[model samples]
Structure formats: structure tokens, C-alpha cells
Target: MTTDRLTSILNGIGKEISNRQLASILTTGLESFVAEDQAILRTGLAPAPYISASHAHRDGITTQIGGERFSVFRTGRSKSRLNFLSLLRAGHEDYIVNDAALDYMRQRKVAPDVIARLAGHPETSFCSQMAWYDHLVRLRQDVFDPSLVREVSEAAIWGAVRDHGLMGNTVVVSDDAGQFRIPNHALCWVHAERLLQKLMPKTPEQTRKLEAIRDEICASTAI
Candidate 1:
């Protein structure tokens, strides 16, 4: 396919699928290019070796674009599903890597085989440690320690007060000003019901009540 056509297809695929999935499709499409003679190879360089079906479904890969490790969720490998959770956690944003070795060659001047070799290099593995450090630093800067604990507490409290009113206010005091102050009763009742189910013997009446609350919560959060 012409570069413009391929680019258009890829852009469309990116909108519908994860990057890893898109990469896999692109790689498969380029397999013929790789198998051809030098004359044909000159026309279309091989897809990045990293973009393989074999590597499609590995775990511990992050979905973050700049993440050193490739995430199956972001990459759309067989192992990880597209993380809808990420959508809830963070808003939509395009994740792209335009400066990778092969891409550079495609746009600028470079030896094709060299580009192929570079694309296949295990650079991601080498950079993972640095990526992890950067992640930690970002977390430290953005998330307050108390806020983390407070979120946990809040989840718990939400469970606790779903049925019964507040026992006490759940306060999350940050190192800085402006504490996360929540009323005791805003706790998720459904969570508490689940805990109760695990802890206590379930009578038919209790089971029905718990199921009703759980269903209600599930309906409210339906996405």
C-alpha cells in the first residue's frame, strides 16, 4: 500500500484498537515485504520485529505511551484486554512513538537493514528500569501519601455506611492544606455487603438484601 494509504489505515485502526493490536496488524501486512527480494525490500522495509504476534500477549507491559515496557492492553496483545479502567482513571489521549528507529528511516535518510536491526533491538527491556524510576517520581510528585490511604479508607467507609449511617467522619489529612473530608455515610453499601457475605453466614433474607444493594450499585456504575 502507498504510505499515505497505510498511514490512513493505521490511523483508523488506532482509533478502534490498541497500539499493540495495530502494530500486530501492520506487522502481518508487511510480512510479504520482508520475504521479497532486495528490489521489493527497497520499496517497503520490514515491519519492526518487535511488532510480532509471538510477543502480542505478554504481561507487565504498561499501557502508558512512554512506558519502557510494552503493555498488552495498550498494545492489544492476546493476553491483556483493552484496559477500560484506564479510561476511567485517565482521560483519552493519543499515545504515539514517531521517532523510533524504523520510523526515522522511513521519513529521513538511513540504511534500511540498519533500521530493521534497530527496530528489532531489545531497547525496551534496557529502558524499563529508568521508566520505573520515572514512574515512581511522578507518583511521588502527583499523589499525596495521605490521599492514597484516604482513598482506601473512603472505599471502606463507602462500604460501611451504605446501609447504616456514619459512625464517624472519614478524614484524609494531606501534608499540605485542604484535607479530603468525607461524610461517614457516603460509603459504598454494596462493598460492605460483599464483606458481610464473606464474613457472615447468609440467610435467604440477608442474601436478597445484599443482592439488591449490589445490583443497585452495579446499575449506578454501569458503563
Candidate 2:
């Protein structure tokens, strides 16, 4: 729930309450719960990983565009969905390689392309070839192996969750490759049924049995 809506409900719907009054009213029970000066509420919930074979959702839209979503909410307007991009720097920041790093990369043939801000430019300044992927892959060649990368990424995700104070209460999720890796997660029935779906039945009887089992699982899950 948003603060403005909560404030309206507290005072009265459509009430004109000042920000100072709202802040004081909202913190009425601070002594009972809050111990620190900070009180954040988000993450480990929104922008969580999606590990489905068929994820035809807006999450797919953002991921395909190389955006790491930080906030996703409807604004109740024409353009409603909001998202944040933390790891989508085009080529300007840390991904901008230093000359020594470039020389080292050149020596190892692990070089990224020099990019241009605009067309019709004579010279090029250095930027990542594939953004963050290139950085990880470059590191993979030297330090981080694939397994290490996965571990590090998982750690980073959880760290982000903590940073946002999403884990202060509790986090729950359904089992899927990326989504289920949280601290407290549970198995999802649909994902579990994918196991049976993967089977290549050699006979009609086997296929029939598998279908029946899948149906039963779905019906049970619905309950």
C-alpha cells in the first residue's frame, strides 16, 4: 500500500492532511517495533528472479531489454508500470575500460569495442562490447568460473534484498530455477509437473498415465 492512500484512510478518504502530520501519525507505533532510525520496505518480493520455461509476462519484457527492475507498480494511468534500471549503463561508467586494462585485454585478445556517442565520429572511446555480460565473461576467463559467477550473482541478489530491507519480515516464493533460490522458498506445483512433462513416453499407455498424473497434480494443487 502507498503512503498517500494509507494517510487518506487514517485521517479520512480525500482528507487534506499535511506531510508533517502524516509523518507523525504514521510513526505512532514506532517504539513498539522499530529499533533503528531507518525503516525500509521492499525487495525479496518485487524484481525477484523468474525461472520458468514459459514466462510470458512483463518481467520477461524487462529482462529481454537488459533491465534490472527495482520497482514495478501500476500508476493507475495510461503508462502505469514503473521499473528501475540498475545495471544498464550504455557504456559510460566502470564498463569504460582504462587504457592499461584495454592493453591487457588486447594482449589476451579479450578486448571490447570502442564505442561512439553519435554517428559520423572519427575517433572512438572505449565501452563494453556486451555491457555487464562482457564484464562477467571477461572475469570468467580469468577469476570467476561459471559456478562462481552463479554463486556470486545469487549472493548479490540476496544482498540487494537485504539492502532494500525486504527480508526484515519474511520472504516466500515458489520453486523455480532463479525464483526459488531465496532463503525461505517452497516448491511450485506447476514447476513440479514440468518434470513429468519432460518425459518422452514411448507408448500410449505411458503417455496416458503421465497425463492423468499431471491432471491429478493440478486438481490437487487447485484445492
Candidate 3:
């Protein structure tokens, strides 16, 4: 419940701790602390609330140690299954790559010169650099499949997630095929709703029909 204390503990030895280890440590301590706080409140002892439970999963904490940075993102509720996707939906040229992906890229005929160039360009995002490499490969190779780049990239992600316990339970939620290419994926509802709102009927007749349909939906929901 003590955000400052937790933050201090994490920062103190965060550089030495892996994410999984940190998560385990926090979970055990937080669970016990929350349970004790709840018990104390039931006995009418006024205790200052240290942690806002609701915001715990909605906010992220990032820390820098030894010039290397790590970010911890919390998604509300403990999930056995998870949703994975990119934050942006640009073309193949804007995909991000992880450490595992670097080796995969080398195997996929990405040249050493291209890799070295990308390594020097700190301003360019991992995905963008990856896309650029894909373009280079397409131009250099005679027998080339652009889809193979994505497939290899996705496989790399799947392997990492599986190692981290997501495995088959990870659902890919993205509009872009060049993004995460997991087998089980669904369109994001928020995007779909926004797109639906943008679609307006051109004719009065169509508008009238759509309005009626909306009313019918509302009426059914009310019932």
C-alpha cells in the first residue's frame, strides 16, 4: 500500500532483479499488506490508505538503473490470458524488434551493414528500422517473400511470450497484419466504435433507416 516504500524498494535493487522476480516479490508483500489493512479497518482503527488499489493496474512505472531502463506496466486484474499489439499501426516499416528478434533477423538474410547502420541510429524506432531492413531485403534478394519477415518476427514474439507464460493464451489485438501475427486475434472494440461513428449516411433515407436501427438497439438494451 505504501507507494513510496514500494518504489524505494524497487529502485534500491531493481537493477539486480528480473521482472518476474520483482512481480513475485511485490505480489506477496502487497497481498499480505492489503489483507492486514482491510482487517484493521474492520476493527474501526483509522489507517491512512497507502495505495489506491484501483489505479494500481492502470498506471505504469519506469525506472532507469546503470543507464539501462526498464518499464513495468500494470493491466487491471490478474490475467491468465493477455492481449498483445503495437501502440501504433503504421506499415511494415514501423514494427519494433526485441533482442531475440535480432538473431532471427540475421538468419533471415538481413545484412550486417544494415544492422550496423540501424544500431547507430538511436532516434529510429525498432519497428521502423525493421521495416527498412525488410525493404532492403526485398530489393537485394531475387526470391523474397515480404510475409516471411512478419512470420519470423511473430514467431520470435510468440516464443518470448510462451517463455513468459502467455503461450497459447495471448490474443493479438491489432488492425495491422504487419503487427503481431498471433493465430487468435480480434479487432479492438474502441477502434471499431470510433470507425462506426465516422460512417454517416449520405442520403436522408439511409439516415432515417440507421436512426431506426439505433432506436431499436437502444430499446432492446433497455428491456
Candidate 4:
């Protein structure tokens, strides 16, 4: 099927569909349609430049090209639910070794065997591996904050926009507890609704109250 036809069919739907199920509908040589659908679902997070109104989900894809590794993080879509703001290469790499990180592990008196297991490699000695693990742990500690992820991600996206010379505002919709601190950030309705759906009232009064609230919401939405 053509990309336009597939998009039209998918855009018409108001329900959720899984990637595996969507993939199954394809025969062969129609792979681009699936990618386009995913791009739409991701709100234009593809490598090519495109402005998105809003509609983003916090998701990532990993790939290696020309022997270089890349970690791509897609900003959640905006309220308009049109397209993604952009795709940013959140690079992956090993941590740098330093004295502080090593001192930390030494102070904790990490077991020798455990330390050896973490550090040992086919091409390196146990001591070398220990240093590598310590460096990695230190890097992890530096970025342990959830807010840090959001801050860096939003900055990278805006930076991309500036570099590409694009104009327009983009909103981001992500989980309530996600690490996305964009100016246009908003919690995903689907996730919020799912939480509400999970509510199980124990008492009769609670059940009635929950049902009344649900009914009101449904009525308001004309569902």
C-alpha cells in the first residue's frame, strides 16, 4: 500500500494499535508505510526535518552506522497530536576514569570477586575492568536525576530547531513521571486515563463515586 493510503487509514482511527499487529498487516516492500506510520505516531521524529504541532511519546531507537553508535530520543507529541518536534542523537559512550569514582568504591570496600567480575574482560585485566566499571558508575551517578534527562533532551531538540532554521512551536506529551522538562510539556492523557481505569474501589460508596466520575467524563467527551 502507498504511504498516503496507509496514513489516511491510520489517522482515521481513534484507538490504539500495537507495532507488532501493524507490522503483520504488511506483505513486503511496504516497509516504508510502517515506518511512516511510526513517524506519525512519534510526531515527526524522523531524521528528515519537519515541524510538529505537538504529540510526543518518550521513546528511543538505537542503531549503528559507519561504526558509530547512536541513541535517538523522540520528544513526546503535543496536544494537537500531529508530529514530533525532532529527533536528537543522544550519544552513548563509556565513562571517563577518575580518582573520585575509584575512591568511592574503595571506601565502600566492594568485594574483590564482585569488583573483578564487573571489571574483567576478554582483552583486559581485572584491574582495568574495575577501573572501567568505576568510571561508568560515576557517570551514571552524575546523571541519576530524572530531571537531567528532560533538561538535556529539550535543549538538544531546541538546538536542532535553531540549526535547521525551522519556525513553529512544538508541544511535548509524556508520562506524568517521565524526564521531559520542555516548555510545552504536558502529561499524556492516555497514560492518565489508564491510571484512572486501574482504580478499583473497595467499598460500595467508593464504587458509586468512581462510577459517577467516569460517567461524567464519558458524557463530557460524548463517548
Candidate 5:
């Protein structure tokens, strides 16, 4: 039997195929490419990244990677939902383009025009933003912001994912800020539930609403 015909019959509308029934059909799908080796799932995060069977990470992949022995299998979920998580090394490590690390160039006896190029121009908003960003990078190392780190990590990850053969059938269904930028993109509704799950609803109405939303998400994402 052809893989496509088998998939067509399994996924046909009004066609309910049980897992055991599909034993003859290979259980593998596009997601298997990554899940087979790198699908280390830890949940309790915003629904955007959550698949169904997820475990929450008390510590985080970041802390685990700190030790001399960084094992991908042992790396767990992050306590903070905003945290950047990945199985790869060198995440936004450079934090910016051009490994050129220059600091406080104004103190030197360089010419005014030379400084003009390095320093941001007031008119150019992009230039100013970069200057501000560079200044922040020069700050202390403990300044780890998950959102910002994810922003950088996403760019690197996107490049690698595209360059490698992870496209076509492989669709990254995530509601995270940047997953849609990938080649094959899709969004998951369950992430909305994650946000509600984290909230401490005050009123009874809010509690009821939260429960309703979660129920809907569970139905959508669950098998």
C-alpha cells in the first residue's frame, strides 16, 4: 500500500481511524523527523509551544546546559513560560550581528566623522534602536530576558531549519511570535488555553470563562 493512499484513507473526512487499526500503516509522520530524536517535551507553558503529552520543567533547559555535561535527554521545561528553550547549542550567544564587540568608543581620541558612523544618527530610528540594544548587551551577564533571547534564538533556528531538510511535510504548528515565519507554518489554538491556565482569575465569571476556554482547547488538541 502507498503511503499517500494510506494517509488519504486514514485522514478522509468522516473517517475515524484508530491507532491500532493503523498498525499496518507506518506510525511515522512529518513530525517524526524531529520527535524521533529531539522531541523533548516539557509543558506547563503558554499553549503556543505545548503539544499534548507535555511535562513541566521545575528547573529549565538553560540551567541544565550550564554544567560540564549537557545532556539533551535530561533537559527539561522552563519554570518561566517566556523562557527560550531548545536542544541546540549557541543560542543568540553573539546576541547581535558582527562579532565585533566595541564599547564606549567616545572615550577614545577618534575623529568626529568616524564616531558619527559608529554612534547612532538621531534621524535613523533603526540606528538608534541598534545603539540602545548594543548598550544593553554591554550590561551585566545575569540580564537574561526570555522574550529577547527567544527573538534571537528564533532567527538562528529559522535559518538552520530552512537550510536543513525540515520543510515540506514538516509543519511547525506554534502560536509563538515567530514560528509562523518558517516555511511550513501553522498555528495551534491550545496556546490560548495555556495563557488562561496561568491566570489567577478573580471573579466567578472569569473562572467559568477560563474553564470553558480550557475545555475547548483540550478538545481541539487532544486525540
Candidate 6:
């Protein structure tokens, strides 16, 4: 789909929605798509650019245009009544178009004016909304401070603590390279210990010594 097409769809939806409401919907949709990856960062994984899974969710409406995903949030009693949930559950892969026409078409009916308007309009609003959505998605993917501890240097970690008011207990001092601030609730300390144990030397004597050291650290930080 092109930006023009997306804008037209959004504008069509906008006929029944306020600008603020449209913005809210778009924002909410994007946030739901991106939140999981953001939480993963708090796990101390190296931050990497990833696509939001909004397109995959049952409640999401996604269209792929120009190699990017655009999604919208649709909810309400009317949506369910109109067979939207059924379509979603059945995994129908159609883009949302103008509202009244969509409704009419649902019952195997058509309105010429709706089709005419869609064809005549340049789809400027649709294209612009899509551009904004793409920009927001890319921005979120690029800005990962929490999950990607590998990309974060020691100085950056300190800076985050100071600037972002991040708590200390959530941060993990992994090695000399830097300290990582992982999600306190999500950090798998057992996994980290396993990795640390793997770093031990092959010699049984050295392995035993390293195991003792690992035990001490585990005891100190129960999290």
C-alpha cells in the first residue's frame, strides 16, 4: 500500500472520529506493538532494531505498504456487532477503507459516492498519517536504552542513571565494560550465572575456583 492509500483509509475512519481520537488510536496501537520489545531491553539483551508485532495481534489492523507495517486499533460494541471480531479471528487480511462504504459492502451492498470520493481524493491524509506512523515506529526501534546493555558503554550507563532517574537495584554490573540496567522483575539471574560459569577456564582447578566466585556473587545479589 502507498502512503496515499493509507491516508485515505485513515481519513475515512476520521469521518466518524475526531482528530484527537485518531491520534490517540494511532498512538495506542503503536505503543501496544512496541511495548514488549521495550520490556525485553530491561532484560539486558543488546538493543537491536526490530519490527513491532502489532500486525500479528488478533485485535490489530495492519497493512503492509512500501515494506513497512501500518496498524490501527479498532474496538467497541459496534465493531463486534459488525463482524470485525469474526474477521479478525478468521484472519481476514483486508485493509480498512471508508466507513459507510465498508458497512454497506459488509451486507453485499455498495454506495457509488463512497467509492467515488475515495477514488477522487488524492489520499493526502492517508499518506501523511502513514508517514507519521512510520517515523514513530522507526524512532521507537532506534531508541533503545534499556534492553540493549551491550551497546551501552559505562559512561552511557551512568548518564542514563543520572538523566533518566533509573533505580540502582535494577542495574546489573556484568563486567568491566559497563553496568547494565535490566528490568528488576525480568532479569533471569540464573541465566546470567550460567553465562558467567561458562566463562570459567577449562582446567578443573580453575573451574572450581570460578564456581566458588560465582556462588559468592549469586549469594550477594539474590535478584
> Which segments of model 3 are wrong by more than 4 Å?
1-4, 7-150, 156-181, 208-223
Count of backbone clashes, every candidate in sequence: 8, 0, 3, 11, 3, 9
User: Any runs in candidate 5 off by more than 4 Å, and if so which?
Assistant: 1-55, 58-74, 77-85, 88-149, 173-223
Q: Write the per-residue lDDT of candidate 6 for residues 116-160, one digit (tens) a residue.
A: 433344431212224423432443433243322112121222222
TM-score, every prediction: 0.19, 0.31, 0.27, 0.26, 0.26, 0.22
Tens-place lDDT per residue, model 4, 1-223, is 6545565577679535555556666555776765664444333332322221222343432211110111233433342111122332122111221222223233445444433432442322113324544543553433355343323233333443433332224344456433333334554455556767899899999989988877665674452
Q: List the residue pairs that clash in candidate 2.
A: none
Lowest summed lDDT across 10 adjacent residues in model 1 is found at: 45-54
For all candidates in order, the CA lDDT equals 0.33, 0.39, 0.39, 0.39, 0.39, 0.35
TM-score: model 1 vs. ground truth: 0.19
lDDT of 5 by residue, 14-108 (tens): 66776555665555464665444343321111122222112334455422211112123434455232233232212222222211111212222
Give me the runs in candidate 6 sitting further than 4 Å from their true place.
1-188, 197-200, 221-223
Question: Which residue pairs clash in candidate 1?
Answer: 20-75, 21-75, 61-71, 157-187, 158-187, 158-188, 159-188, 162-189
Point out where model 4 deviates above 4 Å.
1-189, 220-223
**lDDT per residue (tens digit) for residues 10-119 in model 1:** 68776555556655776676745534432232122122111111122244432321111222223333222123222111221222111331342343344455435434
Model 2 TM-score on a 0 to 1 scale:
0.31
lDDT of 2 by residue, 1-223 (tens): 5577677686785677776788788778876443221121133133434211112244233221111333222211121111111211211122222233233233333323321111123222323334434545544433345444333333333333344433433333344545233444444676778788789999999989989988988896675
Off by over 4 Å in 2: 6-16, 31-173, 177-179, 182-186, 194-200, 215-223
Candidate 3 structure quality by residue, lDDT tens digits, 1-223: 4555565677788555555665677677576665554343322211211111111233442111110121122333332111232211101224434444455456556666645543344433334445645544554532266554444444344334333322233233444232233344444444434555677899999889777766655574354
- Model 4 sits at a Cα RMSD from the real structure of 16.1
lDDT of 2 at 192: 74
lDDT of 2: 0.39
Most lDDT-accurate candidate: 3
